[model samples]
Target: MNHPLLDQFNQWLQQFEQTGSVIDTTRLNEWNHLMDQFQTHPEQLSSNHAQWIKTLAQNSKAMMSVVEALQDQATDSSEQLKKLREELHQFNVQLLLQQASLPQQMAPLLFTHTHLSTLFNEEQLAKFEQLKSSLNTPQFEKLNQLIESFMQWQQAGQTLTEEMNQITELATQTWQEQFDDSLSAKDQIELWGKIYDNTYQVQFQEPSMQLAQSGWLNGWADLKLAWKQLLTQLTEQAGLPSPEQLDRMIEQLDQQRRRIRQLEKRLSALESGDHNG
Candidate 1:
């Protein structure tokens, strides 16, 4: 009673009519009714092309869905790969920083064991060695901090030494403003005391001429006391070590003192009132 073959024949006829050929709804409806009547009988006709085409359409949709799912996975994989690469780059940067610090961490130990060890204390040597042996993750952290502090101190000491040299040169060259209007009375007094520091004896020549000037004689004794105190503080500040450096420094001071004393004596003799100017 089912006449699927006749059904297909009528469907093909309808497609043919719709393709550039005129179609009449009246005739088409009559044909469709006849086809249905045959199809209902169950023994009219049969064909495989229409069912195969229907199955192909369903398979195509499933294949498209699978392709879209694969694309999404690819995009997700790309994002994950980017994140992993950035993490790797950060790890490399951390490794480089850690590597750079290794030498500084080892310097104190190396300095203690090298020929420079003779210049350092036995306690310092032992401490550095102990620090080297105790570099575990859970040990006392004071050793690491000490090493870092030592490095910073060494750099600062070098910088201070250079600045001190420049200061000494400036002080010596500016001595001509000795005690006049060029520098304030206070500044001149301070500068004079700075030079006389570490020198042997402060000999005054022709004290009578100096006494003749009003207020000068009284100020002289007080200035001498002030100078002696300033010299003591200067020596303490200079932090001289080793008796040899002290001896050499004293010799330099003696030479300058001799020159300044002779100059003062000659000037005082020339200014004498009881003799020729």
Candidate 2:
């Protein structure tokens, strides 16, 4: 009874009995039932299903196109980023190469600056004048040019230093105004002390002070050497005794005086003995 071929034969017999035709009556009944279900035409459902499939196909194509476009954009962006990184790396390498040579390039300039500074100091001018006979006109002119250049650089440095000091003072004043306005006197003192220790002392004032002190010491040493050289030349030219020669003469005089004193003591002792006899 449950055999599928027999069931089909029965359906054929039922359709033959009803309409004199061998149509599948069960399928026909199902179509009729579906037609009665909705007020619209049955073919409209098929048409809607077809339209839905077409729309899904179109949407799928459009989504695939968008995905492809996004992939292309991502590839382009990645390539551009790679190029940018490569350029940056090359620029950094160039900067490093320049930095490596900077110290060597600056060394001779620093030496000239210090040398000109040592020679042109106002305190050493007198002794520097004494050196005039030793130098030619060209040498003096060259020295003057170097001194002028050094002075220009020094003036620029001083201007920059003043600007930096002003900035620092302004920043400190701003900080005080912002945070210390309501502080107690003792707290304000502590705040300033901290600020000095943390910022101004370390960053500005202390280094500047140390640089000035070092310059003074170096200038003093150079001045002393210049004075010694000047005096030695003057003494030699004037036919006056040098310091070493003067020391030797003083040593001889001291020895002669000691011998005279010893002789006088001996004579005094001899006289006393004679008187006692």
What's the TM-score of each model vs. the native? 0.19, 0.24
How many residue-pair clashes does candidate 2 contain?
0
How big is the positional error of residue 131 in model 1, measured in Å on the Cα after superposition?
5.2
Task: Please give, for residues 1-277, the per-residue lDDT of candidate 2 as tens digits.
Answer: 2543335546655766787654354755543343233223323334456555445445545544444444445657555434434433333333322422213323353243222311224544444444443455663544433333334334433443443444345545545455645789578657755764465445445566456434444444443344344445557669987655776899999999999999999999999999999
lDDT of candidate 2 vs native?
0.48
State candidate 2's TM-score.
Answer: 0.24
Winning candidate number (lDDT): 2
Q: Which candidate achieves the best TM-score against the true structure? A: 2
Q: RMSD to native for every prediction?
A: 41.5, 41.7
Q: What does candidate 2 score in Cα RMSD to the true structure?
A: 41.7
